[model samples]
Target: MTCHICNTPSNESFQVKVLFKYDVTYYRCHECGFIQTESPYWLPEAYASAITSLDIGLVSRNVRWAPTVEAMIRKWFQPEGPFLDYGGGYGLFVRMMRDRGFPFIRQDQYCENLFAKHFDVTDQPAGKTYELVTAFEVFEHLADPVATVGEMLRAGKSILFTTKVLPNPNVTPETWWYFIPETGQHVALYSLESLHRLANRFGLQLYSDQHDLHLMTAKPINPTWFRWFTHPRKVALYNYLHSYPAKSLLDHDFQAVSDSVRKQPLKDLI
Candidate 1:
């Protein structure tokens, strides 16, 4: 198999089991240190079922952290215009933003909300551009993250994304449940360095805050106060940071994402 991100051959890479039902296997690239499933096929029906079983409340929690995200968004892309929520599931975040008065569009494979639009990152409309685009918990599922992100950059002026970052190099398939290769969904694993490398490759500046969530904002330049945030050791850092005095930022971030969603024209898919 070939490494999806760097296109290097995966002949000597170590294999890790990800999921049980689907029998997914991921290969860790020796050259780029990227972990991904080998020749994985997308089983939409199975994936959809898995997603449906997840708690809706957990998905809605993005609203609680919106303020901090918004502050970062404003610092990066001050003038928020048309925005797109790539892979926005069930329009919960979109609905939250609409309620808060931000005009934005929601696109996902499964969502059918009136406020939602359907779009695939690999097959986006030509000439469509946005002031901001957000994709939370979406990158790890990709087979070719480099190509996927390149398409996102082509479709937007700025991007706000969140995903779990692997910090420990020693935690192998036996120690981490996330590294299991059985489920082909989470093919790519990233660290802060890998994420930054991706941003640099696409000419985007990245700012990441570790809280109960991994909030990452990427644009053409680094946002103000970005240098002050501590690097995340794990996803748990997000929860720890939010418990401190900085918790107020979460509300603001939620408002910003919500406000951006309300301004979008519901009729336009692009």
Candidate 2:
């Protein structure tokens, strides 16, 4: 088999049962330290429900990460510029970021946009690139990892994403909680080294926390700035200070919607 990130030859590493049914073979690439399962034939059944039931932390995860992303945006990215959330499940994070004053658009072909309506990528004007594109907890599920990352790069200059790196040395479907065999959604997994190769493949600089969060950009950044802003205390303290108060567009959005409601022709309304 071939590694998706580096396009190098990979060897069969192990086998694990997925979705409680199929025994899946996993391949590991020595060149880039990437691990991937055999072409996910069970994915159609696996994703019958786009968000898996095992994901109980969905709300809390979004809540916890929003502040860090906000801090990162204010410091490194265009704070008031357009952004996109690729594979954004249910638009929860999109709504959270919008409320915090970032103009974020959602893009998820499978999931419904329950919270952030009128903000789908499909609703946006064409040919416009974003300041940043985020894909949290979505990379592990990709069948075509290289193609998906390229698609995100085409939409934005910077990519900020999160995925638990496959543990080193001693790793197996039994040892790693992230393996998530029951859901069978985690097909492709990356190590920190693999991620660096992924960035190098696209000629982008990478800053990683070496846990879950990572940023890839064409622009030069002092990695220290990224570390500081992403600290939990820093995010909290920055919000507390409100030195540059968040320019929330809540009222503006409401008024715009109300005006559109008023302008509709009576016959068309019915």
Candidate 3:
């Protein structure tokens, strides 16, 4: 079959037991170094629930990534421009960003918006552009990387996303946590070089922490500065030392929601 990224013929790489049941075969793209599971017919069963039960790190991960992202956004992008959290789960990260004074909205086709009600891409005006789009830990689950990335680029020129890069000498099936066999959702995997090819496809510059976090943008960025901005501990320290954004939307959100509730039909409220 053809690689989704480059449309080159891909070769079978390995087979693994996914969802602890189905035996799955994965293919490696010779041209792009991308790996994909063979035509994921199991996805219907796999995504019976959008956020799998195996994802225990969801909350802690959001907390850990928030400060670093906040610092990076404050450093590079416009702080007040509208932003979107692509594939955002339960609206947690979007709520967090809004609390920090960034005008952010959640965009998830699958997940339920449980936390930040009234803040979704569907709620926004059509043809609206964004200052930036963030898609953390969502790349591996993409069934069609090229099409999805194409949609994101249409919305914004900059994308900050996260996906674990397959390491050199890669790991045994038993050791590769990125495989995520139980959930059967991580259908595609990529290396740093593969990600670079992805960025180049759209004429965007790619900067990675050489691990999970990456930024693809039209703007120029110094590699060293990008590294510094994404550093977790330093960002945590800076967050602790300084008052971030200097304002919270706590009262504003309260007032807005109150107004919306007042405007709704009495029967609708009930």
Which candidate do you rate higher for TM-score, 1 or 3? 3
lDDT of 1 at 254: 61
How many clashing pairs in candidate 1?
Answer: 40
Q: Which pairs in model 2 have colliding backbones?
A: none
Q: Could you estimate the TM-score for every candidate?
A: 0.68, 0.93, 0.94
> Can you write out model 3's per-residue Cα lDDT over 1-270, one digit (the tens) per residue?
898888899988889999989999988887878889988889888988999888998998888788877877777888887898999989999888888887888999878998787889998999789999999999999989988999998888899999999885444477777898889999989988889988989999899999998999988888887787677788876666655545777678779889999999999988
Scored by lDDT, the top model is 2
Per-residue lDDT tens digits of candidate 1, residues 124-227? 46577877778877787776788888777776856777776665654466776655354445667776656766777766665665322333334344433553
Assess candidate 3 and give its lDDT: 0.86
The C-alpha stretches of model 3 lying farther than 4 A from their native spots are 169-172, 237-245, 266-270
Candidate 1 residue spans exceeding 4 A from truth: 9-19, 50-57, 114-126, 180-183, 210-224, 227-270
| Per-residue error (Å), model 3, residue 236 | 3.5
- Model 3 reaches what TM-score against the true structure? 0.94
Q: Could you give the candidate ranking by lDDT, starting with the highest?
A: 2, 3, 1
